[model samples]
Target chain A: MNSEILNIPLNDYKTTVESLKNEGFEMMMDLTVVDWFRKKEPRFEIVVQFLSTSHNKRKTLKTFVNDEDLSISSITDIYPSANFYEREAFDMFGIIFENHPDLTRILMPDDWVGHPLRKNYGSGRIPVQFKNAPKVD
Target chain B: MKDYKVKKSKLSNFKNKLDFWATNSEEGGWNISSTDEGSQKMLENENEEQIKIQTGTEVLDDFVIDEETSDDERMIVNMGPQHPSTHGVLRLQAELEGEVVRRVKPIIGYLHTGMEKTGEELNYFQGPTNTTRMDYLSPLFNELVFSLTTEKLIGIEVPERAKTIRILMTELNRISSHLVALATGGMDIGALSMMIFGFRERELILNFFEKTTGLRMNHNFIRPGGVAADLPDGWQKDVQEILKVIPEKLQDYDDMLLDNPIWKGRLQNVGILTTEECFAYGITGPSLRASGYSWDLRKSQPYSGIEKFDFEIPVLNEGDVFARWRVKVLEIFESLKIVEQSMHNMPKGPYKIQDKKITPPPRKRLDESMEALIHHFKIYTEGFKVPEGDAYVAIESPRGELGCYIVSDGSSKPYRMHVRGPSFCNLQALPVIMTDSPIADAVAAIASLDPVIGDVDR
Candidate 1:
């Protein structure tokens, strides 16, 4: 077991990815977008969580992407499980995963019109189609 | 199978009649006039105070229609939305040929409560309520991940006593979560005795939890800076009593199933997940550990003062149903060790952070100090704002590496929140595991995976 795992900064995503690749980090566990609406230029941030089984190390790579075009290089080729996660990001946050195979909605249907996780997304109550409505209290 | 086909067609025709009645009844005139004589006759016979009846039998009929038209060459089996074995509203559409499952597509979203979006709208203090809903069975771990991330982002130092209490509660929750998985998983695979044993032991743990957190299931005790309140008196004694009793109960469980030929036959060499595959699917906790990977957040990252306690990360090379079960069972012992150590090293200090901005003043000071009263009023009305930053925190939950990613724009509420639910990720491997396996074995595979549908759907 390694004595210490390094905490890399968010600015050096490309370098960190290359370093992790060199260090035998073969799996990209999860990729998600966190929207920091208070930030000036790039209000949205992307978190790339990785796991290296050989070295038994886990690292989170963070980066800021503009809300105008939320795009990230696809890690599906590196880790097949990433396909669904990236598709989920697209479905929930409107972040586009470039070069991802089968990059359609995985959880929600294809026709789901809006990204539900964004800060500005309206929270319209979905009408209950069942007999007993949920208690109002 | 032949009998089902005949009944299914009859049910579909009945459903068509029901739909026609519903739609045509709204169109007025002709439809109402045609049915008026029969309706009037029925109304006259019925009592005035009789309750109106609506049948969910239509839903059952619709499912039969969906089953019949699905395809003849393939056998379509619906595994739960209500079935006890699916572990909570998870429905699977499995295509089978005889006993072998050809393909399985998991149909989720039955438990969708929009928790991630709800977290964004709620303030930091109220965030635990949303977290508690994700993994309802293991709510403390959900609260732990969110609280840890918020604390890291804001850079607040939780008191030593609070940290020790957090570790104790977290380990206890882990044991409870494993017991639930064991109970439900065993029942899924047709082991009735194991289910009873698992739940019996689980009730003891939940009893201990109720004493500390004031709730059995959704204990919103852990918060951003620290725990909600100080440990109740004699808490250490209760924990020690549980620690002393659980070891023997766990051994009884092992005797009942671990070496039994029937249990071994069903679990061994079933649903094999390779090391590469486990990593690819982002599998963690006991599931990943079973694949011979010794990755545990408590040992590796050491959040909430977990480094103070010593415990082993159990690993198995088989990576099958039995191996996963073994890892979880062994983890119960290790969690007990952590809990014992945490109790021994319990410190004395304030439970929550002392900052008036983050934590409200004590009730006694509200009447004494004007500043305390003002601070309490402000914090409750407009919650403390987090810094403008983002952080992702992951914990070794019973099922896997449950993670939370939060972004705060210096506001009381999170701008955006996303959960890296292990069940959601681990469930993706179901299709891979079920292919070519016997349809019965698919249930065992899913049971061993222990995918909670609430976590998956959220």
Candidate 2:
């Protein structure tokens, strides 16, 4: 229940993950991004959840990413489970996973325009089209 | 890893040789250059088929590969965006060489309604309504995890009665969810009776849920501070009926499927997933337990005072479709035990926390007291503010580790809310389980994994 939270630098994210992997963290529970548009200096924060099954512990690894540089090295090499998650983060927040295999949008259509989860992207902006329904302005 | 040498199709006479593009999202449909050559080079340098099954000991005997089939007859097969067996809009593209599955890619997102985007817009109070839709089978678990995260951020505790109520409801929900998994899994493998029996038993639990939560699915009953309402009068009788009937029905399932040769043939030694593979893929719940790993979040973490009850985490070493099915069957018994204990030890107190900011005053009090009326108005309109910090709370849902991570900016609404859906993570293992197996086994593999697309595409 007592999860250790570590805020690692962007450069040290992979190294920290590797060390954690060596330190009995066999399972990567979850990976997601929180877009802090104007509130923080860095526009996005990548949050990774790791579980050490042998040690019976959980760890949360967080790293910040600037708006200008939206890419981070994918941890799919270490935790293969992160494949879909990284793609989801890419689809939602537009945070490119640098070495992700098939880094296409996993949750959105391929032709969709903007990241939906980003603060700048407004919800209910796109109108739905029905065959015989009347169109709304 | 075995290499699949695919021969070119002998249709050169045709003007255009039609290549099967599994998904429109896959190459040349929407036309996004998704292939990363640098990553490809790195993976190739490391090893082909980079999915590492890191068993400290020798791999299990069931993971035996058959004699190499001729790749000359290889073809791409797309199963389900509409197929009933895929369990809700999950599309899987498998490379098949003469009925043997070579590789699989699960193309999700058909059910993506941008719920997470909608979560950013809803406040902490309204959060459960959004989350309950994800993993629709176990709606209470989603609500519970979301509420727990919100409560953690707010730094408040519900009463003992509320905790006990939550445990009771969630355990029953687990039984219902597992019943659906068993039902659908049975239906996939040609056991029509099981589908009927599972639903018949599950209807009892859904009826109980409706009596308590007012709706069958997407209850949104379990709130941040506590449950929305107290257990309805004579709820004990409803639970007692479930406890009485489900065990009898489960015995019937065992008799029907356990020793049946055809059932065993279809499930056993098919879709083998080693513990190492499960760990690598982050597959928890029965799938991970089926692979001989005993990692249940409820027993380990003990949220919402569930540690008060006594139950066992059923584990099997087979790591095949049969083991996964059997593990779920056994888990229902354990969940039943927890539910029975919770029923006996049901506490008598408030359903929600006593804090005025978190819980609104009763309707009678609203007319009597002016302050109570004001509190209700403010709470409903503005909502209670959580402290400026983030917390992630995970619980052992029927599926797996259902976690909710919430970031608070000292506001009523969550700054960012993300759900770590176990189905989504478990779907990553489809390729590992389905590869080198027969095409028929792929259906069983998917059914055993039980990737509910609502959770995956959420």
Candidate 3:
């Protein structure tokens, strides 16, 4: 029932996932991207959670990714269920998943411009259409 | 119980065969051979198909629009985004060949609300309101996860009474959620009576929710340190009323759907996802339990006094729609048991935490003391700050493992707040389960997943 959290090297992230899968991390519970835009070295952190069904244990793995090199090797090879989540990360944070067969925008319109999750994205400027207002499109 | 054991052993044997086949065959994942010699030939053909996929001759990617799709053999169709049986705004693109589904690609994002980004904008005190709407059906779980994660960040503990009350409310909500699953899933497969019966039972639970939390849905009762309010007068009787009626109604639902020939035909063998498939896709909750892997966060990673409760984790090895239905119906009995235990052990104490820094002063204190008024004003406006740390707290929602990952930079607002929604992740298994099955079974498959689009797109 104990949940363990570890910080693995970015280069070893793929290997860690593979080893964890082999070690009976039967399913991935979740994968999230965190933006620490003010930090000096790493701007983004990819937090991955894997679950052992038999043991009822959870292990969370975190790896750092900077804005400059936003790419991280995909774990879809080990966990096929990570496909949608990786795509969601790509859509929200623009953190690319390398070796992902179909890495495109998900959870967002395909034509939408810029990643909306980065800290710098403007939160208030978008105009809200009222009932009486004419459609912008 | 005997039947469950037999099926579970058979499933383990099936897995061993697959493991044996995996090592012997050159083909890797997702290419399962048949039971006998059919598998030998499939191994060879699967290798060729892998080569084609590598060379771009066969674009096996599910999401893309394939140009190589021949017009003569198969045709493509979209099931929903607007269709009724879809349960929500989920679009499934199915490639069909004479009523057989080749692949079903679920197109999501129609309900996207940018909730994660909005979480960062809202301070910790307002986190529950934002998260509660993620899974509109199981809103309390969303609040629970957000609250649990925030508590982890701040290192605060709820009172014993608060924990028991949380356990009580959430267990009731679980039964309510499972009822909706039965209703919508049964309705999808053409069981109109089951839908009515399911909703009837759900109404009773929702009524109790309305009485306790002041709202039927999206009750932001749970907060970081404790719940927002205490149980209403005679609330225990309300829970006891639900406990009285649900079991009898469940019996009615079982008699109607469990042994019906048409119900069995539609859901028994339809949407079979084996244990290995669940592992590969990271699917959990009822779907995983139906697949024979008994991993529920309540049982495994106990939180909010769940460890003290005595309830069995019902599991089935069939990994089919019927198995999921059966598991959910059985789980309601266990939830009822939890409610009964909680009622017997109910305590009398303050519901919210007593700390002045965390919880606002009572309204009476505001008129009596200027310091109390100032404290309340500061707490509401600025919100209490959490130390710099990152934490992920996952709880078993009705659908699956719903997790909240929060990164705080010692600010009232979160540095980042991302939800690992079960609906979004469980939806990935759709293509795997729906492929090669009949087109009709796809409806049952999706309904069995019990995915709420709000949770998927949040």
Identify the leading candidate in terms of TM-score. Answer: 2
Best by lDDT: 2
lDDT of 1 by residue, B1-458 (tens): 99999999999777666655755322323344444221101112322211111000121101122343334656767677677877887777676666666556666666777888888788998999889889888999899999988898898888888888888898999998999899888898888988898899989889988887889988899998888888889887888788988899999988899889999999888877777677656677788899788888878867878887889999999888899999999999999999888888888888888887799888999989999899989988888999987777778888888888887878899877778898998887776677667787878888889988879978
CA shift at A112, candidate 1, in angstroms?
3.1
lDDT of 3 by residue, B1-458 (tens): 99999999999778767865656532334343332211111112223322222221121222334567676768878676789888789888777876777755677888888998899989999999999999999999999999999998998889999999999989899999999999988898899888898899899999988988999999999998899988989887888789999999998888887889989878887778777777777788999899898888898788888999999999998888889989999999999999999999987788888988789988899999999999999999999999998888888888888889898999999988989888888888887777766787888988999999999998
Give the higher-DockQ candidate: 2 or 3.
Answer: 2
Best by DockQ: 2
Worst 10 residues of 1 chain B by lDDT: B52-61
- Those runs of model 2 whose alpha carbons end farther than 4 Å from true positions after fitting are A132-137, B1-71
- What is the descending DockQ order? 2, 3, 1
lDDT of 1 at A113: 75
Better of 1 and 3 by TM-score: 3
Give candidate 3 misplaced runs (Cα > 4 Å): A129-137, B1-71
On DockQ, the stronger of 1 and 3 is: 3
Residue pairs with clashing backbones, model 3: none
User: What TM-scores do the predictions have?
Assistant: 0.82, 0.90, 0.87
User: Chain A structural similarity (TM-score) per candidate?
Assistant: 0.75, 0.95, 0.90
> lDDT tens string, model 2, A8-115?
999999999999999999999999898888889888999999998898999999999766878899888888888888989998989988867567777877777899
Candidates 1 onward: DockQ, in order: 0.26, 0.35, 0.34
Best-to-worst ranking by TM-score: 2, 3, 1
